[model samples]
Target: MKMNICMVGALLLLGVAASGCANNRDLIAKSVIPARNDVFTEGGNGAQAGRAVVDFTLLVKSNLYYLMGTYGKHTAPPYRAHLNIDGQTTILEADPILEDNNSVGLKAPESGTGWKYQFSKRLTLAPGKHRLSIALPIDDVIVEREIEIRPGINTVAVTPVYKRKMLRPYKGENFSAGVKTVEIAVN
Candidate 1:
């Protein structure tokens, strides 16, 4: 009789444990359903869905000697940068130019000025490759590149630096003819 009672008790305990697991499974499913609703869609069709973000920074290079010899001071003129994402163009106005007066960091050369500006935007891109075009209207320069945006954070750096060779004097003049060039870097 004791053995039969123990078997009945074990079966009851097993039934309780199985029911608990079923409740836990339902709880897990309920928790995930709301999170799945927050997914971002890149296109109208239900093709691509996920969260995508992009961080972009702009760095402008300046030569201290060139500025001192030519203009006697470092200056950064305001310019606008435009980004084309998936055939959509967005304009980003340049912040007021700032000259770095502090000591140079180890990564930078000591003789030059690093005029920097930055902007960021979160993108809802499809889960595949896309075309991105960056345009600096001040210099009339545009760079077209393809990038694959995954379901996480992506970083990009756009460096616009004037080439020293482009500033040569024209027709034996002491001052150089006004010329500007942009160098782009992507990361």
Candidate 2:
């Protein structure tokens, strides 16, 4: 009789514990983009810019890290990557790309578009990996996906784009639209 009572108590406690885990995934209150968070799609939540930027921002709860993306013509004279990590801002330029920081990326890496480049930056995360957030202050464009980190070694990519000037005479007069693709993933 006593054994039966104890077994029932254990099962009850197990049920509650399982439910707690499910709730945690929903804790991130917000994400980087206003639309659904899908990196594989174009013009969804995040927008990849050219040398001419349409800036944006993103917001999150706590703990978790987020990434932004950019791509463009790499072999040209104007290429820049500007990032803001927790308020501390850093800008990467091409002169340093070849001089000190081996920060190398393929020029126009994407197929068909000889003007898209992709790259990332990883962040050192804290314990209790909270909600993931990536802000795009450039035109309110945020690029990120959901993730759960255990403790150490957490990373994110911050991609800002610089584009060659649109020499096309009709660019300003008409609607000019182009797509530059960059990707972020983990094992």
Best by lDDT: 1
Candidate 2 stretches with Cα past 4 Å from truth are: 1-109, 135-140, 144-146, 155-186
Residue by residue across 1-187, what tens digits does model 1's lDDT show?
9999999999999999777534333322232222222223322322224655566666543322344434222335345566666556555554444455446442232123344445544445545576666765444456667777665565666655442333442322111121143344444
Over the stretch 109-187, how does candidate 2's per-residue lDDT look in tens digits?
1112122223343433333323334432322333444544444343444333322225743322111122122233332
Taken over the whole model, the C-alpha lDDT of each candidate is 0.48, 0.32
Clashing pairs in 1: none
TM-score of each: 0.49, 0.27
Top candidate, metric TM-score = 1
Taking all chains together, the TM-score of candidate 2 against the true structure is 0.27
